[model samples]
Target: MRPSSDRQAPGGGPRDFAAAEWTKLRSLRSTWALLALGTVLTVLVSLLFCALIGPEFRRADSAQRRALDPVGLTFTGLQFGQVPLVILAVMAVGNEYGTGMIRTSLAAIPRRGALLTAKLAVLGATGAVWGLLTGAVALTAGSTVLGASVPLHTDAVRALAGAGAYTGLLAVLAAALTFMVRRSLTALGVLLPFLFVVSGALAATPQLRSLARLLPDRAGLRLTQVHQDAGDLSPAAGGGVLLLWAAVAATGSYVALRRQDC
Candidate 1:
């Protein structure tokens, strides 16, 4: 019988590239730092919202209180914290381009598609873990301070799970955008404001609210709300829309990576 070593296999497939990408991400101090910052900011901002809102909520009329959603409040910190997460995801691709190390990376891997896929895999996993953690923290802290609680049997479970998916998908989209832009700052400049500021503003406007809700952040964040908003889609639908955006962005990025020179 032939030895295992004698058998030939693909040397630099997606799996191998993914492993290499994971190792590269793990080796970066900035990666760890940004992740930590995102997590910490999420928790702190959640706590702050609780501290401020809890008191006002306690004083509000029953009519006003009836409209408030505890789960929505829990996730308020994510709005701010997600900024850092996006930065981290974009930087995974952005750093290489900025430092002119993309040439070196491409020289070693040669397959741009595989490299891009590997980075997405690593970022997806990282974002999911942190998103879940941040969601749980926000939920607990907000409930404690606001004295607002939701039963486990309700949509609370879906909300929590959605939080994880939302973050992962958002990060994946950011990575794809970074690949297309080839500059961390440029990607950040576009993504952060749109997701954080512009999306929210548009969603708040009477004229554009309907169209704006279709944006990735607006659609994705809806899933994290324990109670449904008047105009919001179902959690499953919202998640699907977010998934669609990520898929499109990834496809576009793959095409750009394959066609463009490093």
Candidate 2:
């Protein structure tokens, strides 16, 4: 009988979890499409809005332009940009569950908590890098179109950084929810209403005004605006709120993943 060689299987390894995630991310057509859409939407809308408002401001007297927060003008597209961010984040996590790949993933990475953590780390890093480039491009392009000087104040820079952080953190949050809920469509159902309709309504309600400012979407929005409303939280405070949500969501996902079987 011939001796069988034992080196390693063609597929299995200690790094399989990360490799699997990388494959899933790259192979999924939606991932690339969504990312492209997010980038284009953010940059284009900012340019368009700036183009519309810039000429009007230029036509106005110096006094009128002085009163405007030029810094805020550059990020006007942030409001719309967030929609695609949420979608990308949601699909990243939710798709795994939807396709029943999480089970296979968990089986391979039996240390389920670690697997989720790795996923969050990978997505967060990707988000931060892409977001920084996108924000910088949008800000620069929008400023040129608007004919306004870019604000370099500490608070302004911090707020711009916060915008990138918010995108990455939200991506992790979306992933976590998928682990806990195991239902992509349902998670989106919950996420959408909470982000859009409910948050907007809450922000408008005087009775719920305090809580509304602390909500994830509301808080994240505040960070991108240079002019703080009377009731608006500071950009730093908004960052904290977003971070809190990311932490909570991540913890919840880890707990569920570890305790439950794939």
Q: Provide the TM-score for each candidate, comma-separated.
A: 0.88, 0.84
Clashes per candidate (backbone, < 3 Å): 0, 0
- Tens digit per residue, CA lDDT, model 1, 181-217: 9998899999978987899799888999888878998
Model 1 misses residue 64 by how many Å? 7.2
Worst 10 residues of 2 by lDDT: 6-15
Off by over 4 Å in 2: 1-20, 59-67, 150-156
Q: TM-score of model 2 relative to the true fold?
A: 0.84
Q: What C-alpha lDDT values do all the predictions have?
A: 0.84, 0.75
- How big is the positional error of residue 255 in model 1, measured in Å on the Cα after superposition? 0.9
The deviation in Å at residue 5 for candidate 1 is 12
The model with the greatest TM-score is 1
